[model samples]
Target: MATEVLFYHLTSQPLEAVLPGLLMKCLERDWTVVVQCGSRERVEALDAHLWAFSDDSFLPHGTAADDHPEHQPVYLTDGPDNPNGAVIRFLVDRAVPGSIEGYARIVLLFDGQDPEALAEARGHWKSLKAQGAEVTYWQQKPNGGWERKA
Candidate 1:
């Protein structure tokens, strides 16, 4: 099966607000997820954010250094390693995956405010399409909802 590649253009909301919900959706489907960022600092910050993103909600996640990757429902890292055997991979903050295959879905979330991020996302879309992956582009609407653009 071809990997489903999704590009999320962050405009109305920051990743902190959007990511938790997406992760929750994956978890509801009984799918483990791996979120990869560009730097350790970013990954650490995300680890903290996921813990306190909502007062009523909790996301079961941990970093690579935390160990027990197999126990975590969601894993966060800066490297291109999938220790948890996640079915879905989220590439955030311009993080590029070494390979898109094997995963059931691959999500690329980039900031619309950054020109460089947008350019990188475009290149990724083209490359993934060329690899025969099913690609979808989502744009954040003014109401903070996402709309499928392509």
Candidate 2:
């Protein structure tokens, strides 16, 4: 089975601003999510952001170090382990998973302002395409919305 890969180019907003909404969408679909980031610092920062991203909103999530990983609707980790049994996986800040096929959907969010991040995303896109994955590229619009470019 080919995995559906989505590349989100972040320009108008930071990951903290956009991630909660995306995770919320997944939750709406009743799909558990695993968010993998580049470093422990990034993971911790995201965990904090998800809790305080909005005054009126809150995303129930926890780090790998937190207790009861299987109970978390959204799991955050620096490694590529899926203890939460998530069907959707989010790769942000250059965190590459060991295999994309295991997940139903894979979202790669990269910072557009960083040349290194852009190049890495491009490489991942080409690799996944070559591997016969269904891939889509979404560019962030000026209004902080996403537009599918490819």
Candidate 3:
């Protein structure tokens, strides 16, 4: 069973300070990482920078199966309407039988600044738990650096 690691970040502010080490850990274990974020350009920028160490990192944009071959990070969008809803749906959709295989783990990276995004993330966390997927979340503090509170 493949592990589904869901990283849901509200923005890409602290990803540079946080994700590199975590990403390395996943790569070492051959775990697939799905970084769902609101900023596509920032996420891609992070992806381009992180490839210095490994090239297996990716973000799902559609039905693509780990489609990114380069070191660039895959980009997912969270537009205006139901921003958080889109993320929850993506994770749920991926967890369906045969949709994703192997050990499944999801890492949700979110920002604490946005009240709306936070509330939506918390609610969606419950939905994620109900779906039988292990979820972990991290938020970047105002001073910088990632803090895992849940």
lDDT per residue for candidate 3 within 92-125, as digits (tens), equals 1112222223334545555556686567677766
lDDT of 1 by residue, 84-149 (tens): 999899999889856987999999999999999999999999999999899999999988899999
Cα lDDT, all candidates: 0.92, 0.92, 0.45
Per-residue error at 111 for model 1, in Å? 0.3
Model 3 stretches astray by more than 4 angstroms: 1-13, 51-103, 135-150
Model 2, 39: alpha-carbon shift in Å? 0.1
Residue-wise C-alpha lDDT for candidate 2, range 6-75, written one tens digit per residue: 9999999998889999999999999999999999999999988898889898999988779999999999
Judged by lDDT against the true structure, how good is candidate 1? 0.92
Residue 138, candidate 1: C-alpha displacement in angstroms: 0.5
Which of candidates 1 and 3 reaches a greater TM-score? 1
Better of 2 and 3 by TM-score: 2
Q: Give the higher-lDDT candidate: 2 or 3.
A: 2
Q: Mark the 10 consecutive residues where model 1 has the least summed lDDT.
A: 93-102
